[model samples]
Target: MSIAGQIAASCQRAIGITLARMMSRRQFGQTLFEHQALRLRMADLQARVDLLRYALHGIAEQGRLELRTAAAVKVTAARLGEEVISECMHIFGGAGYLVDETTLGKWWRDMKLARVGGGTDEVLWELVAAGMTPDHDGYAAVVGASKA
Candidate 1:
């Protein structure tokens, strides 16, 4: 993976770590208000966040975290971004969208980085599913398909 992919994958890992921390919360209000946006997304968002977090970690372990890896990370990260920041933006009803301190506006601007950087979304799907047989068909042959 490229340097940007490496950083993106690392950020994914960091987000997972933070999510694990958030799961310990006893109440939704505490999770949302007590924690920062990053932490709130983890605690309140639970199911989807956990699924993508685990998936991103799995993809990172494959090594060479590329744009694909970034895409995979974005699957979870984007959901969280949509929920936490976008919700805040909605709550503000236009005001938050304009304010950088709330970070909804910043996230709205910065979202492109996560969406396309490292790897595009298509690349991530291929990476996650181990897409395509080579012309030589190495994996198929290993499992007892006719030898190439």
Candidate 2:
């Protein structure tokens, strides 16, 4: 999850830089940032990043870190990092592919590591599902009570 968070943070920085560059260069009588469609897309990506950050914070606040919580965050953060980085790359167009000009390509390459490292997304989801099962020792009471 920590590695995933780092990926997210890096992607955020790349997205910010790309957006700033687009805003500085006018296109079609207005900067790309001024386009309603582009603005909405950026807003959605920002919200996803913020959601992942807040979820991680919530998990930390529990004091006792549970495997389920860790798995959930890992899945979310890795997915969000991949999404945000991809969007940033689209915004950058051909320039994002150039390693010398921006770290977007590097970030894109590293994002996959987050998904595969520690535990794969499928493995993490299975962990989460196991935690929710009534037969699972830790969640037995909660799951049982919900059924009644």
Candidate 3:
């Protein structure tokens, strides 16, 4: 599996763990999931995960992964993995910091390595930027244009 695929799977797992914990526990006479703010953040995380999957599918269909495109996906996946897992840690509260049987702690430690793996974020960002055209249509070229 690609790095993005692994990150997506980890994000999905963290979300599941967080949701289960939230629903099973209550704060102020209501489940944590009942809170509006928490739900909104969860929705945003889900949206990001879905978009990452869409990008992966698109790349797979192309049957080619340009260096710039691969860098972009790697950077995105690593950042998203960090963000999603960190948010879950916050939602998990002090329990997240504990050394326990849960995979959250393991994922947390592993995700920090992702930023430096498969090339650092700075180098990848430079690669992505270098591929951008200077024309007015550069935005479209960098993003919406077909890889072919």
Candidate 2 lDDT, tens digit per residue, 2-116? 7756866786797788789778868889998898898899989888877777766776677677788788888878888888888888887888888898888888888888888
As for candidate 1, its clashing pairs are 67-118, 67-119, 68-119
**What Cα-based lDDT does every candidate model obtain?**
0.51, 0.82, 0.88
**Residues forming the 10-long window of minimal summed lDDT in candidate 1:** 1-10
For model 3, which pairs clash? Answer: none
**Stretches of candidate 3 above 4 Å error?**
136-148
Q: Where does candidate 2 stray beyond 4 Å?
A: 133-148
**Models, CA RMSD each:** 8.9, 4.7, 6.2
lDDT of 1: 0.51
- Find the 10 residues in a row with the least total lDDT in model 3: 139-148
At residue 120, candidate 1 shows an lDDT of 57
Q: Per-residue lDDT for 81-143 in model 1, tens only?
A: 445445445433454566554444765555545556655556666775673346566665676
lDDT of 1 at 34: 55
Clashing pairs in 2: none
What TM-score does prediction 1 earn?
0.41
Full candidate order by TM-score, most accurate first: 3, 2, 1
Cα lDDT of candidate 3 equals 0.88
Q: What lDDT score is found at residue 114 in candidate 1? A: 58
